[model samples]
Target: MARTRQPEVSNDVTRLITQIRAMIGKGEELPPERLLADQLKVKRHRLRLALETMRDAAELPRPIIRRNDSPVLKSDVVVQGTNALEVIELRIVLEPAIARLAAVRASPVQIAKILEAATTPQGVTRTIGDIAFHKLLADSSGNQLAASLYAFLRRVGSDHRLHVPTASAITSERIQQRDQEHRAIAEAIAARSPDAAEQAMRQHLRRVQREIADRLNPLETA
Candidate 1:
């Protein structure tokens, strides 16, 4: 029997997707059609087609919008408010289970990647890097359903960050605190203690949720 050849992607489309992936991987916001066309050295139509294909293939996630269907603007106060609420809801539903599975199934290499992502000293905290870590943790959990759910939750988190201010108020002390929490989670996983890992992760997420809520509702903070 003859082997069937795979469909080849056009050079232009491939190049455009590469550029788009690079921008997304670095957590950079993409510009609109005209700017993307210029950056990718392609026609506007080609760029649009490439983007559409990538989105359809799930390489690019869908945009989150407001009630009127306007794309959420990153600097808009209303978008930030919406994001603050959404992130809290997502974390409460996702992290505990992921942590439990990670404790049972994460291999040494996967655990190391999670620890490195959590501990890295980058000038700007990269949301992509953090997300990659979480995804890896989910994969390591050896549960397909948990992994899929984590992926969805991560997209929501990414959209929220894109439309909202991140922890601009993150101080050195706060970073250290986060690092410690991550370490505790990692250690519990390494020890194969599912209960401990889940508890640690839940505690960390609750702390993060409270901080974000406090920022969103200063009256709560008071």
Candidate 2:
């Protein structure tokens, strides 16, 4: 008997997820099926199949509510740039401590995973991949306190993306900077330098905070 090829279901799901992430990066509010079908250039049925696959993979959550109405512009929504600044500020207070704990608690496998995620080509996905990498780092840290804080930080990052216009301003250079900072923390952790990791992480976050503050309140220093 001839060998049969498996359906590329996983590839389809990954494609869908990438498209959705790209749309989110551009701050576009996409319609569900039509957007998927149009972007993926697949039939509605295939699009639905891809969506289901993604949902199963936990790349997307099942929709809680469906609407037949037209999209409404939310004028009351806060500007996204400001929201991103708030998220960065919150992380400045939270992630350094997580880094410290991760240094003390992470297993070798978990540490390797964290480093791999931070240094991977997929890390170019910017906000989405970066957030996922940080979540994995927190989980690897094996500290409940750090895990909870990481979850909170992830939520804040998500909310910031939704509300902040310039959130996708993450560039290759910026990603490189973030990757280096994360690598420094990870290396310190691997070396059992908890205090050094914490300090490096804190310093990186402080620089981020300062950059955000400069953009948000440029007149403050004058």
Candidate 3:
């Protein structure tokens, strides 16, 4: 029997997989397909074949295509199924560490961005500012994996549907307090005080948890 030769695409797919694995190991997000194909010196069609191979092998998370043909992560569905409290509890565990790392690792430019994000602009929803502030901290953590994970967490946490039950609890006073907490965390990171950053982040999350719990308990009683 003669040995069979694999198609050229098989080799290209293997190369693509190897490169993607390297990027993952380095805690970097996969680049856009066109840019990645260019970088790998592979044709777009070959890149698509490589992606299909990975997907078939269950090597990649199944992507849900939106109306715009954007791929949303499978984990997003799981997050959407979970309640807000669960999301906040996870944030309590993850964000303090992120803030600590940001304090230690954030560049001056990142610090400035963090500070800017900390303040909610007039006529803008505080929720948007809050998300931006925390996201900046995550991005500043100098760990791309952590940053990516936080982005997922943020998306779920910010989903209005998840927080509808506690929406009434978000008063002007509470928003002010939350903004103050954001500022505190930003200041700690700006000062490069890891301990302070960690503590501030923990305190802020705990306060949010408490408020949500207070609201939920009343609803349950009713």
Candidate 4:
């Protein structure tokens, strides 16, 4: 006669994912299950459910995986030579999936951070804000494997667009358009619409890839 309640494992999973992200970012290994459960003030059973979910997502032998130590994969497929194009290719593959997860799993605080980053001012803050906004999406996704791979991709040989002079690449109109695009993606995620979020992210990344291509080959546009 009474409605059955879902096991409280989702909250536990979110908490564990949050802690694991922080720990891995600092190069700190996760403590044993018993210790973590005690520290998190959760029962072992709930903690175990969360731990198992995370373990499956990780699929790694070790708890804390450092970025530098990750194995390099040799792929004969897709664009691989140019750093900028390669980074764009990976974004096309991963960002939409991450956004879809973020739509369902992101916490209130995480959403707030994403919003804040999206609205942050340009100049020095622009670069940092852009980085934070994207990283926060991955963090919100609650998928450590995706998050870690995104992190590694950001650090590896890429366009390093942040360091490159923004004078040419970042025009005033471009900045305005980017703000609108980011807000659209953020809105989709905050509204918890996975399909919308995925589409929004995909559209944004495609625009970026196109811009880079056009820049690299002005003759193509001509």
Task: Give me the candidate number with maximum lDDT.
Answer: 3
Local distance difference test scores for all models? 0.69, 0.65, 0.77, 0.71
Error of 2 at 94 (Å): 2.2
lDDT of 4 by residue, 1-222 (tens): 999875455765787667765554333335787897888788888777766665554322225555685466532222244457678788889999999999999877677766766664534345555666787788788888888788767655333442222226456677778878888899999999999999999999999888767776777886
Candidate 2, residues 33-148, lDDT tens digits: the string is 88668766877886787667655544343554536554342322433334766667778777877888878877766676566666535524666656666665566555655565
How many clashing pairs per prediction, in order?
0, 5, 0, 0
RMSD in Å for all candidates: 7.8, 8.7, 12.6, 8.6
Query: Compared with the true structure, what per-residue lDDT tens digits does model 3 show for residues 1-222?
Result: 998875555665788888875553333446788998898888898888888776554444334444675546655587657987898899999999999999998877678767876777665566666776777688678777787789888777767768646545457887788889999999999999999999999999999888778777886746
Please tell me which predicted candidate would have the highest TM-score against the true structure.
Answer: 3
lDDT of 1 by residue, 1-222 (tens): 999885667887888788886675454557877887887777888887778877566444444333584544433453455565576677767787888988877767667656665663465474454555566567677676667667655555556453445445657787778778877887888888999989998998888787767767676657
Candidate 3, residue 44: Cα displacement in angstroms equals 16
Which parts of model 1 have CA positions greater than 4 angstroms off?
1-83, 123-126, 160-168
TM-score against native, each model: 0.58, 0.56, 0.63, 0.62
Clash pairs, model 2 backbone = 80-163, 80-164, 80-165, 81-164, 81-165
Clashes of 1: 0
Instruction: Kindly indicate the candidate among 2 and 3 with the higher lDDT.
Output: 3
Comparing candidate 1 with candidate 2, which one achieves the higher lDDT? Answer: 1
Q: Candidate 3: where are CA atoms >4 Å away?
A: 1-73, 167-170, 219-222
Order of candidates by lDDT, top first? 3, 4, 1, 2
